[model samples]
Target chain A: MDSQVTRREVLKKGLIGAAGLTVLPSVIAACSTSSATTAPTAAAATQAPAATPTPNANILTGKLTLGNNHSDASDLKGVNAINDAFKALTTLAVTTNTVDHNTFQDQINNYLGATPDDVFFWFSGYRMRFFADKGLATAIDDTWAKVSSNFTAGFANAVVGNDKKVYGIPVDYYPWCVFYRKTLFADKKYTIPATWDDLITLCKKMQTDGLTPIAFSDKDGWPAMGTFDILNLRMNGYDFHVGLMTGAQKWTDPKVTAVFQKWATLIPFYTHGYAGLTWQQACDTLVRKTAGLFFLGLFMTGEVATVDATASADIDFFPFPFMGNSFDAEQALDAPIDIAMISAKSPNLAADLVNAKAYMEFWAKGSTQLLMYQANNGFIPTASDADTTKFDVLTQKAVQIVSKAQKITQFLDRDTRPDFAGANAMQSFLLNFLNAPTQDLAKLQASIQAFWDALPVYAGN
Target chain B: MSVTVMAGQRTAHNVARRRLSRGALYVFLTVLALIFLWPLLYAAYTSLRPYGEVVANPNGFFSTPATLNLNNYFFVWNGGNYPQFYLNTALITIPAVILTLWISSMVAFTISRFNWGFNMLVLMIFTAGNLLPPQVIIVPLYRLYNLIPVPAPLSDNGLMYDQIIGLILIHTTFQTGFCSFVLSNYMKTLSKELVEAAMIDGAGVFTIYARVIMPLVRPALAALGTLLFVWIYNDFFWSVMLFKSGDKRPITAALNNLQGTFFTDPTVVAAGSLMAAIPTIVLYLILQRYFISGLTLGSAKG
Candidate 1:
């Protein structure tokens, strides 16, 4: 009987706890209502300033929301610093919502289609235009009109929609190039290859010297696309490459087959078991002085610097060797630009338009870009006036390379529809080629074309 | 005397054979345990080393204690918003688990105790809900969440979308099907005599449910609670899909914050993953006995 009474008391306490647990959401929800109540007053501030040409003249004061995808520790700090600068200059209170970088990229379509923040981070090139064409993003042409003189023609074209309206502010970009340790090159007395034949001879020499001629890895699937992009740009031209990505050109074009046939010849010189190694592991060979050359982005310096802080000083890169084609002089390369844009679907877009435009205009400044560049040097500023004197040797050279280019393309994924360029599609298709480089090029091209043809047509909103 | 000697020799030979077999079994179990523990051991080892050390000597299988440090943990802990994420996860998980257990147990009592015309069909329907993949209905569900207008205290947004309450509802609704099926079968094993005795003693249905059946199924409830807590706590997909604010996300979502788009510190990521797993590990340890019994409970007759 004593045990039974004790059990009853225990049961009574459990019931009370269960009831209390069920009521917790309401308490949380109630607490959050304080912030929620402020949203309406901010939204009600939408006045007769939608027609104003001068964003600064309005002195807009209200709450604006921003969605950021730079979730990395240093990157998040950079974003916060930029926001702090913006808040200091303007009366608008910015609410920045940060999501995981990859998650943000994966769910962008769903996010933009639903309720989106007033302003958000994005990539330039086809993706920026793709969303603008779908009417998911606001046209910041007025903001661009004021700041166009601050940027270059390449950046100006990058943010333009199919309808020729400017949609975003191009903030920063990093280029893909062949990186090598300058000390190794100096020790071996190796000259930077200027032509395809010279590159082959250098690889042969590196092989005889008992070094992996090219440190390569395709485990991430996207790294292989870098090789393909540079090869295509060298063999064909910028127009042809962009046409292929946009489906205006066929994959089975003899020119496309030629690029793969050329890549197959250099496959033997890649690091052994590259399919099982990540880009970082491949980058390690360069760091350890076991490899002759590494072909990757400017961001490779960031990876190497983490291991050896002084290593980046020894790192240098040359553009991929000329393939003796007419497009060689075009100096085309993949320098994907990161942009920031305002979302059209934001509920407070009307009220937030003035402040959002101010935020967009603020990003257009070279000084603003310099702030972010200092925070994370992996991304070089696109604005021409961003103090070049502040750059490290590699960044200075990278800027010169980008500015000299007659044509520029975004990375493959950023240049095409996400579904076609996603992990299941182009990533695997590229992996399939690398697994067996000697496979029939014609059949591979046909399969690539078939995959593109079968995709549902992307209908704009 | 010769016959007795032969019997003694046979017993000694049998003992030798049993000893050899036991040794082999022990060897097999040791290898299996090592294979299962390899990934966890590797992560823990990697988490202790500095990022540069791991990068320089990725294949280093053996290292001195001097090389191993908690810098990676400190780096991730200092960098990430772990405390807020933990609070967010707790808010979503505890309530969802309790609600799911309470609702399912009542449904189990009703279905198992009384003889109703639709009892078997109801159980089958509940079981079948578990078979439908959550992905199939996500698009429509997203639209539905946006369309639904909720009160202020229930949802700060004044809508079901992007609210913590929305996550709790979805978790409870989806998990109830599996919990109800398991609890009903367990409730069936309880003798009807107890219910009949309670009814005879002027006990109402609610009284019998609260006083009699709940106490009996405490073990199963504890097991289910542990499982549900972990599932809801570690949920990445629903929270990612439903919540818009970064600070509103749970701990599982916080792991992604350690990984960068262009650059990542693998040691920091490994440390973050282990840190995120601590709560679930602690809960499993506490309820392990009930969990083990819960698994085997339905296999044997009561």
Candidate 2:
């Protein structure tokens, strides 16, 4: 009986131990699997440059981590192609950690606060400035010096902080404009409006023809900001708009009120149930010929192409019609520029900075931007010297519009404090305005101002 | 003869009343079933259709029969890296469920079977921990995870930030509370005489807990184990927050990665969701008998 009890005790201990033992190897194996997969890519990075050495080969070496938000398959392909090009040109081994695009943007503060990648994708304007001021991002002034000739002064200015330090390398930009179907315009004999009065007349004509004049959606809460930004820029001019965004100018000012009042005039012509629909759904209304026009970024082509591949050919856009105000040059447009920046919290800061600067320098090259543009034509290349000869008709038109502009503003969200913009302050205000346009503009403006005041003032700002 | 005829007519009336009520019940049940099944049916139907067709007819479910194909499943399986995500999920789920069950059961066994100082307080602590919202702890937990360093063999990044073990630990820690609570209560309902009998028979604490008490609480364990598996498997927030690497993310979190930045194909998303649902569905089905009984077992006592 004693022997039997001992055996039973031993068996129980063995079972308990086995449960613990089973998990360890699996954990190790899982880690090994991830490391093994990355090992091949690192190996490939070193081996490829050996096959065909270019002029700038071996300029930078060692593994550089890149936090990429290019979650789209097509965009990922383009980014990968560019990275491969960079690896081939300069022997830097870049290991990319891709995250969901929207999530990446939302969690960027936390990601940067932690051990972030050596280099990461970001946008320019106040958003870049905010991070740069926080010392979260490394200044790429050395990189800028090498590629200064490739970009315009405007592009360079977008990347500079308030402290006069370059923080990011602008890669591509897309303009927010009034997108319309060319074929539908042709069928209806509708002429592209050149001014605010012409636009109102066109809207009236569209309404008479039994169509929604504007395909508007604010379901995602940021699309309507595009409309508000364009209106504010048109009505208040660039300086006031920028001042208002930076909280230097009061939201309750008459200038802001006028912008809202002007926006109210077009509410009758917007798509019914606009709040229920997403931007893609609004774009669908245009694609299906149910709506006359959509005011969105150049990415609208992506939605149109998804439904009918050939329909993209019929898609064209014009600048939001000049509002016939003091700032009626159509100069101030929303042209959000995507930029790449090196993180200050990089694990191997010195070595990673070398690789990151080299990568940014390569990105700033016109030839490199041209290669990227060739891979994905969603946005215009930022480099002034980028090859535009091969640009599609729509892209060329976008370039022409941007080139002629005296001022370009990033979108409303990108221009202001993220806390104010991201926390439904502007979005809800715009949504409320959309819901009841004629309701107290003063109250709306006051609320917006109050919310802005409530934010913890950034010391750097 | 008149009385007999009246009696027969009353019987016929009663039969008709019963049949009418039964018909109503059937109708109600059918409606309820359809209400529950419609979303699954829609997902399945949408996953079979081409993306363009679905986009064109977003409101309609049964349009464009010609566009229906298995292409989306193929795309989700091959293009979405779903197999890798599934493996990641399994790696996190299995160990988490086992550890949670083992640890929580031990706690439950000790608290229920023995009278010790601060036993109720310990149980209260575990139970109260489960009540706090996950978001409240996210920031502190995120910082903590980043600070803790593990060996290279345990984490490719050599930190807890993107480790599967980190995910498992969080899942186990968070889930153990509810599991132990339910389990302790369930074990309390079991007759103390059985444990007393074991103690009198010279059985050790481990022997009593493992051999005598454990077998009695199989139903509760099975139920909690199933619940833990489903919850951890379907977890998206912790997985995404804890792991930055796409390679380490579970299937639920990986679904977000399948979405294109500019254009997400709806059919592909539907297909991916359906694929992710399969493992949990299979698990629930296999554990169905024990699950229902186990859930009701505690309530049955009171």
- Please, what is the whole-model Cα lDDT of each candidate in the order they appear? 0.84, 0.84
Q: How accurately is candidate 2 docked according to DockQ? A: 0.24
Q: Model 1, which residues run further than 4 Å from truth?
A: A1-59, A459-461, B1-16, B58-66, B298-302
Displacement of residue B199 (Cα, Å) in model 2 is 5.1
* Model 1 lDDT tens row, A1-461: 99878766765665566566446546765666576445432333345444344545535566678989988767777888888888777645678888989888877887887777889999997788888988899998899999999898998999988888999999999999999989999999999999999999999999999999999998888899999999999999999999999999999999998989899999999999999888988998899888988889888887898987878788899988998879989999999999999999876788778788889888888888888888889878888778889998889899988888999999998898877887889898888888899998899899999999999987631
Q: List TM-score per model, in order.
A: 0.90, 0.90
Q: Please give, for residues A84-106, the per-residue lDDT of candidate 2 as tens digits.
A: 89878775667888888977887
- Candidate 2 residue-wise lDDT, B1-302, digit = tens: 99999999999999999999999999999999999999998899889988666557745445766677899999888778766777788789999999999999999999998998898999999999999989899989999988887876676655688788999999999999988888998999989999889999999999999999999888788888888888999998998788777667889999987777777777788899998997777555556666677566556443
Q: What DockQ, between 0 and 1, does each candidate earn?
A: 0.31, 0.24
lDDT of 1 by residue, B68-180 (tens): 88988887766786655766788789889999999999999899888879999999999899899888888899989887988766665566877888999999999999899
Cα lDDT for residue B77, candidate 2: 81
| Clash-forming residue pairs, model 2 | none
Docking model 1 quality class = acceptable
